[model samples]
Target: MNANLQRVIVLSLLILLMAATRSHVFSHFTPVPDASWAVFFIGGFYLRNWSRWAFPLLMVLAVAIDYAVITNQGMSFWSHYCVSPGYWFLVPAHLAMWVGGFWLRRNYSGASVASLARLAFSFVAATALCHLLAQGGFYWLSNSVAEPTFAGWAKNYGDWFAPYLQGTAMFVTLAALAQVVGEQISRHAHPFARRMKH
Candidate 1:
């Protein structure tokens, strides 16, 4: 299979997994295990420039899933939970994750301890930034909060940070493992294929 096609398939699966979390299909489950945080980062890591377009496409899917879930469940689309102005902030937040992945991909070294350390730092920073943008955006800008305040926002951020971070890290770890395995397989296959060709 073509590498690009393989990448597209993998990224599409990631996006679909993330979007499913927001859809009626999986709405009953808690958001703590959502794959969205890793989706953007992994998309950027693999898709590179393709992610610039893919990120927004996934965002649209998320909104569409929410809309479907809302209407299916007999709720007003306009007034669905967290479907407020602050929700738009997710664009930049996810983009931040994407950008972090792009940067990591660019600086990616082979799997040395130092390289793994860099990947870890990048993952944490990106997830934290995404959480802050999303959490802070909702607290400050959403109509859901009648009287938003810094103190209140700070508390909310503290409360939500752990689960969100955990979900992101979980997905990222899985992705990293897949990436390593794929590279190793390709690395081993190259030498074997060459011998056969000769």
Candidate 2:
């Protein structure tokens, strides 16, 4: 397949995955955790060359999904609890994840212990930065908190940080495993295919 075509197919799949799992829109039918964070990370790794368009497209899709879900629940988009001035901070937060993946792609040198270490470090750093921006914005600027203080923010950040990191890590780990398996299958299949052709 053409490289561009492959990228397009991958991007489409990522978009579909994000749309399907971003919220409880279909929770009654099937419960699935949100894949938004992992989608952005994977997108950054696989579609980095198309970031000029891909990132914004994914960001818009995320906001659109949130809007649909909130409105579907019979709540106004702006009036929803999650929608606040700080909600816009998600742009930077998610961008951090994308940047992390981009860095990982740049440093990736195939399957090796060093590469695995880089992956772990990159993901943890990115998740930490993402949580900082997202949670800090929500806590300090959202007005949802009553009399916010540094202590309160610290507590709030600490409370949710681990869960968010764990969730993102879970999806990212699964994606990494899938990529490794796909590469292995492709590597083994190509030789067989060529031999059959000969």
TM-score of 1: 0.90
Compute the lDDT for candidate 1.
0.80
Lowest summed lDDT over 10 consecutive residues: which window, candidate 1?
22-31
TM-score against native, each model: 0.90, 0.91
Candidate 2 backbone collisions, by pair: none
Question: RMSD, model 2, all Cα superposed?
Answer: 2.6
Model 2 lDDT tens row, 142-163: 8678799999999989988887
Off by over 4 Å in 1: 24-32
After aligning candidate 2 to the native by TM-score, how far in Å is the CA of 170 from where it should be? 1.7
Q: Determine the backbone clash count of candidate 2.
A: 0
